[model samples]
Target: MNDRSRDVRSIRLPRWGRVAADQGVVPWLVFDEEGKAVEPVRRFLIDFVARDNRVGSVRSYAFDLLRWWRWLRVVEVEWNRATSAEVRDFVLWLSGAVKPRSAPRTVSAATAGTINSITKKPYLDDRYKPRTIRHSNAVLRSFYDFWIELGGGPLVNPVPLARSDHRRPHAHHNPLEPYRAEGRLRYNPKVPRRRPRQMPDERWNELFAALRSNRDRAILALAVSNGARASELLGVRGVDLDWGDQLVRVVRKGTLAEQWLPASPEAFVWIRLYQEEGPPLDPTAPLWWTLRRRDHGAGLAYQPMNYEALRAVFRRANLLLGTNWSMHDLRHTAALRMARDEGLSLRDVQTILGHAHLSTTADIYLVEEESQVIRRVQDHLAELKKRAQLPPPPVALGYQASDLEVLFGGDQA
Candidate 1:
């Protein structure tokens, strides 16, 4: 046993390998040390794809499973032999382990996780966030559940639920009632609820003014006006625009359903200018195009603006404005303005935002801003002080101070 342990320690461990879509049978697959696909994992991924899961989801799950496989190799345990203790240890390791970064952090340790005065964004560090850990826990449980159901892997799921009782969760809850979450993973890290941060109008104007082109201005204007997600907006085609109705068709992010949302007149005006900036467009071509071009052995050709290109546009704007605003910030700004400033109903906001549930919209935008709440509370206290300074309500319709002093004891008065 000691010699075997030494052998395991001496041998360099193999890292995960990726198979591109062009080279693989499926869209993508992860290979083990011998350059062979882990059969069960491949099967699970095939089933995942069969269920109509997105390519992004497949990639994410593949990496997560690869991590699990690496952990199993280190512990000298077969994948099917893993128990709850293994899952617990895996989660604990993730919590304490420093995630490997491609490059060293630019910010100092002291500044890491602290909000920047200029950008108002936290300087992130090389640690796994609670959300990432939670996602890993979920992926493992699902993977194990798939194998266990087929009577191939462990008898019971290794990633056990936090709930002691194994009865059906929320079995008796009303369908229309707000969902009360239950049965999270035993070792899952708790994620804090973060309120959406909206960019103030002043900062929005600064960001707007910093944009160099009409295309960027139009994208920002449309986003802030309609709350379309960056990817969704980028996916918009020239034919999706309705000039007569002033509505733009966008594919909903979660459901992938198409929806038309109203845009501001100012946004439409910018869109017109942006369209005129380029030559006549094909109706089938993408709505947004890049200014710069890359030679593809033919000539410099402009490409459709993708999410990364859109991000770079904002990255330049952020440097100019010295604010760490994101594309999602525009969505939040539009949602908040529609919900609070425009006094729209939660249902209306949900429809426009393409949220599946009305409660989701209400939960995010219905809450009062912390600063606004504090200001209102301060005003209430000032009003109380003003009331206290009033001259005893005009002496109570002619009752004198002396009479009041006589009515009660002089010391009490």
Candidate 2:
């Protein structure tokens, strides 16, 4: 048999159940007093996810555990008695082995380093970027957290393990820091930097024109007009719209807010046309559905479209417009237009955009036009000229002869 098969067969799971990792089959394993693999970790993981109200989270955790189990079997670690250190090592192995299929150009060096570090002590390399190390550490941390929570081992957070910066004897030293002086390393928390929000108006019009389908146009229009987030738009149902009031009930994050927005008559006409000709409509069904694909067999699915789909749409829009524009920029355009053209207050713009803070709304969505600035400068210059042209102030009232002589140069005036 092959090495993989040999490894799989050697695993001694308890009578409770054994999960078939090879086939994605999770079996319940029950262990006795003498540490033996009994049931599959899948049952426990599934139950845990269900209990935590995260059914979607189980598949990912299960996938991670399966790889961990395979490594443990190969390394001859007693699954029941696996120490925190062993769990840590297993996690490092998993992170490196999982290849990202999407971006083929990039290789996961951090993952490889993590695997090598756990398996062999002398494999440390100084060239690993801080960001890469942090990501590998996070994957390990998550795996250990799951392992501990399942009653398989003692509760130990692996974050500390991955985060610890201990130098190996043979490892190359960083130029910035000496090996002897390397201090306790704490993982830096990741922070997302905000990008400039608004795009040029010409690009916006071009994108709008490029949208081929009525549904696509309507989605973009509503998102731009109402300044709604992708999630809010995805969650929208047919019933959320009230034609009489010209309002839509939007759920932002978790809070529901009613927004008053007037749709153009043409836009309203398109929306009605979409309802009649678009995906089959149930009152409770998602307002947006996948554009029917022949390969997928043509019926509307209840779940709303994903973020990737929205991104693909935006990418297409950008290609057509000959400019890059993100979905958030649409909302920004709406806010800026309201502030500049509609003569709305900052607070009013904030309300329209559904921003939690007025400052954040202003900082991102408000655009300062060069023309407006130039106009203000010109007005200031005109005022100054008018003031300069006025007659000189009556020689300050009390004119003595000597003062008058000094003012008029040679003699008294």
> Relative to the true structure, how large is the alpha-carbon lDDT of every model?
0.81, 0.57
Candidate 2: where is the Cα deviation over 4 Å? 1-48, 51-99, 102-151, 161-185, 189-192, 251-269, 290-309, 332-413
TM-scores of all predicted structures: 0.83, 0.50
Where in model 1 is the C-alpha error above 4 Å? Answer: 1-15, 18-25, 33-35, 107-111, 118-121, 166-182, 296-299, 341-343, 381-413
Clashes of 2: 18
Tens-place lDDT per residue, model 1, 277-302, is 87567888899988877787989888
Task: Give the Å error, residue 205, model 1.
Answer: 0.8
Over the full model, what C-alpha lDDT does candidate 1 score relative to the true structure?
A: 0.81
lDDT of 2: 0.57
Per-residue C-alpha lDDT of model 2 across residues 70-122, encoded as one tens digit per residue: 55566676555555555444434433333323344233333334432211212
Prediction-by-prediction clash tally: 0, 18
Q: Residue 319 of candidate 2: its Cα lDDT? A: 53
